[model samples]
Target: MTEVVIAGIGQTRVGEFWDLSLRSLGVRAIRAAIKDSGGLQPQALYAGNMLAANLSRQAHVGTLLADFSGLAGIEAEALEAAGASGAAALRQGYLAVASGLVDVALVVGVEKYTDLIGPGVEAALATTTDSDFEAIHGLTPAAQAALLMRRYQHEFGLPADGLAGFVLTAHANGAGNPNAMYRKAITLEAYQKAEMVSDPLNLFDLAPNADGAAALILTRRDRLPRDFPHPVVQVAASASVSDTLGLHNRPEPLWFAAAQASVEQALKKAGLSREQIDLFEYYDAYSIYAALSLEAAGFAARGQGWKLAAEGESGLQGKIPCATMGGLKARGNPGGATGVYQAVEATLQLRGQAGANQIPDARCALIQALGGPASTAVTHVLKRAD
Candidate 1:
């Protein structure tokens, strides 16, 4: 396999973006990444997105975006994996470059959550679940997460506010991120008093679906310009795994089996030990998911993932820093665009360009994106080419 390095990365600010169309957001990110890559052109493009078909009445977005971005001649396609759509597209770009199928591959994740209003968004979110079993029963992603949180709290004998730490930490980190949706750090008291979106899950517990896009340019390390301006951040390893889409079918609904296996596979492929992972960019669309991911990734013992957050062990200077760029909770979930954002954010950390969120001596980062609980898990290990 060829050495695939992230030559360039770009992203739109995460927010409602009511004025920006999906194509606009995606093309802006694409142009930025192309410019950042020192004029390297892509032989192929992969667009990751969710809800566009249902909400925007638009399908074939890959071709649509390609034409809109003025790259209609290039091969382009859209990848979808529920919320993990962005990472899935990214994986293809990585393979395209690594396999020598293309000298340069462009990957972009874009979503327009504000395209519609009212119950339409909820209906679209349910598209990721088992329509017959889950959606038919009116169980949405939030409702599903609420069920999981309740189960976790019961089985672990945790208090109602046990997950507060994860929420607080994400917001605290997001406060320092300029591209984050919510730039103000939230307080414990504020979290406690926040309105409940789903019972046992308040507004702060879930990441708001927003409109945003992120892009990355990938190529062989040797292909970079002679004087690349930044440190080399390579995709050391990439692995994706899947399990039962419907949460009810899993043996232990609380345990994210796919998430666990993806991380393990990524670690093995990277030839690095768990202790060497300096940071993690977890798909923290919900706080409970973050807790479960911590346990599943081997960072904490079973039924004890929440403790790491409670003890501030996942903070910037903790045993294993996580969600360093606010994560989905504070960064605002860009639907399918999240995985590309994670790659971009992780690359920043590797390049020592995260500004206030920089982790000292950071080298290796594990980034994971999950689709519908642990139904689909895409994990990647990023290392600074030192």
Candidate 2:
């Protein structure tokens, strides 16, 4: 098998894009990525999207984007796996290149949640859960996260301010990212005073749905042109796992077992330990999710994840720096596009191009994407090609 490497990365600012259509957002990122990769022509294009049909009333999105982007003859398809759709698409691209089936693969994750997209986004998100059992009872993502937050505090004897640091850190880092949606850092007081979306899950605890797209070009390491200017970022490992979709069916509602399993497998495949990761790009769809991810990924002891933030251990100078480019919170969760955004951001760090948010000497990064409250987790470990 060949080694898969990311040769290019691109993204649109995460926010409401009332001016651009879905295809337009995708084309911008795809074109940018192609340009970044020294204009490598992709043999295939894979789209990661969740709400094109439900919200945008458009399907066959892969063909549409490929046609619009002037790659009409390339093999194209769309892959969906809830919020982890982007990672799923990336996984496919990785396999395609690693298996020597495609010389160049383009993976693009895009989502539209504003303007004329209609009011079905929330309903569409609910599809990630067990519709018959969970959505029918109005167990929205926020409410589900609140339940976990409340239980975590009660179980750990924590105060209401436990998650405030997580929000603060994300905002502070996001402030330096021009592409972030919430660029203004928040004070502890503001986090505490923010209106509640769900009890125990205030507005700050959740990442709002936005519109964005991120793209990457993947090819075998040996296939990279000798003249390619940028440093290579190899996909050392890609792993995925799944559990019951409904929170009610989970053995431990607060523990993200899938995240733990997927990340553990990916790390093992990469011949690395948790301590070897220079940084992490976790799915922080909610504050509770961030805490759970930290614990599940072995960044902190169980029930001690929140303490990392409380102790200022989640900052840029902390032991395990996270959310370096705002994460899903301040960077804005652009639905299925979020996973690709994580990849693009991680690539920037690995390439030493993250600007103010860059981690000094960052050589390895672990990126994880969650689907439907940890029901599914896709993890990838990337290493700077030496």
Candidate 3:
């Protein structure tokens, strides 16, 4: 099998982009990535998207982006696995390169949630859950997440502010990211005062829906030029897993079994322990999800994940740094584009070009994205190429 390496990465500013169409946002990111890769033409293109059909009335986004971006005849298609669509497309791209089916693959994740706006986006997000068993019962993702948070607190006998640190850390990091939607720093006091979106989850606890696109070019290490401009970031491992979609169907609703399986498999494949990971890019669409992910990924024991944040262990300078680029909280969740955004941010860190969010001597990073309520997890371990 070929060793896949990220050749280039690009992303649009994560925020309300009423001015740009879905295709335009995707094209911008794709063009930027191509330019970043020294203008190399890709043999294939894969677009990851979740809401184009529902929100923008656009489908066949893969061909639309490829043709509009001047790569008309290339093999292209859109892949969707709910919120994990971006990472699913990435998994396809990795297979394409690793199988030697395509020497160069362009993978992009783009989503437009602000086009239709308001409750429609939430309703669309709910489709990722069980339609008859969950969505039809009027359960939004946030409500489900809130249910998990309440259960976590009750099970652990914790206070209401248990997950505040996650939000604070995310906003602090996001303040440094120019492309982040909420760049302002937030404090615990502000968190305490925030309005409650649900009983246990506040406005600060949930990431908002926004418009954005992120793209990256992947190719085998030997296929690159003798002197590639940017530092090479190799795909050390790519693993994915799925669990029960309905929250109530799981044996343990709070335990992210899929996340655990994917992370363990990824770590094993990479021949690296969890301690070797210099940073983590978690799919923290909700603060509760962040804590659950840390627990499921073995960063902390169950019900002890919140302690990592309270003790400054998950901060930028802490033992297991995460959300280094604001994450889904303050960085803004762009639906399917979120997973690719995580990859792009991790690539930047591995390249030592993350500006204010850069980790010193960062050699390896673990990035994971989740579909609906931990129903699907796609995990990847990336390392600085020697």
lDDT of 1 by residue, 87-206 (tens): 999999999999999999999999998989889899899989999999999999999899999999889986788899999999999998999999888889998898998899999899
lDDT per residue as tens, model 3, 107-189: 99999887897788878888888989999988888989899999999999767888988998999999989999999998899
User: What would the per-residue lDDT of candidate 2 be over residues 104-174, giving only the tens digit for each residue?
Assistant: 99999999888444436667777778999988887787788899999999998768989888899999999
**Which residue pairs come into collision in candidate 1?**
none
Q: Comparing 2 and 3 by lDDT, which wins?
A: 3
Name the lDDT of candidate 2: 0.90
Q: Estimate each model's TM-score.
A: 0.99, 0.98, 0.99
Quickly count the clashes in candidate 1: 0
Q: Candidate 1: where are CA atoms >4 Å away?
A: none
Error of 1 at 106 (Å): 0.3
